[model samples]
Target: MTDIKTPKTWRSPAVDIYETEAGLTLIAELPGVERDALDLAFDRGTLTLEGRSDDIGYQRRFRIPEHLDAEEIAAELKDGLLTVTLPRAAGARARKIEVTVH
Candidate 1:
């Protein structure tokens, strides 16, 4: 008997979304994925992540809030984990209010 391998279908990776005063952060677990095989996109208010590997393939999408800065989003991948950070827009960040005593 000979060993045979079948093609795998795309799957949804495990993800965690966090929101704070600084902004929103998305963390995804994608083992055995290469840096060049990963694809990320942010258009309008949606963010997409896709990766293909010999054994696994996954893709996921997220809707970003309007108050966040879409253009300056940052992404980093290490140890099979992907971290994406979306910083809040300048106007959307919380600011201290000053009171004038007359």
Candidate 2:
């Protein structure tokens, strides 16, 4: 009988999100994922993250709110932890209005 190879199974990473004055922040636990092996993308109000290591892999997706600015999104990977910051669009952020006497 010939030997057959089974495909590798991937797992989802642990993630956490937080609400801030400017917008939202996402934190993902990527134990074995290297910075160069990680992929992040935001499009059409959706956020996608994927990563892989020699032995394991991870993937996850999130629906971003319309108010968030996808163009200015940023992320960082450090010590096996990934931090993503989604800043609110200029029009969506809270601002102070000045009242003038007529």
Candidate 3:
């Protein structure tokens, strides 16, 4: 019998999303992925992340909210963990209103 090789499959990395008054934050666990191999992009209202290392790779996508600023998005990778921060637009941020007692 001849040996047959199967194609490798790519799996979505584990991710955690949090929303705060300032903006949204996404944390993904990508073990074995190198810092230079990661890619981040925001277009229209969609956010995507992809990276690869050896036989393991990660891919994930999210729909960004209208309040968030796509141009100001930033990302950092450390200790196999990727952290992406999306800041809220100037007008979208929450403002505290002072109360006056007469």
Best by TM-score: 1
Model 2 quality (TM-score): 0.85
User: Could you tell me the TM-score of candidate 3?
Assistant: 0.85
Off by over 4 Å in 1: 1-7
Off by over 4 Å in 2: 1-7, 99-102
RMSD for each model, in Å, please? 5.5, 5.6, 6.3
Error of 1 at 65 (Å): 0.8
Each candidate structure's TM-score, on Cα atoms with residue i matched to residue i, is 0.89, 0.85, 0.85
- Cα distance off (Å), candidate 3, residue 53: 1.3
The CA lDDT at 51 in model 2 is 84
- For 41-99, candidate 2 gives per-residue lDDT tens digits of 88787899988776677889999999999898999999999999999999999989999
lDDT of each: 0.87, 0.86, 0.83
Off by over 4 Å in 3: 1-7, 99-102
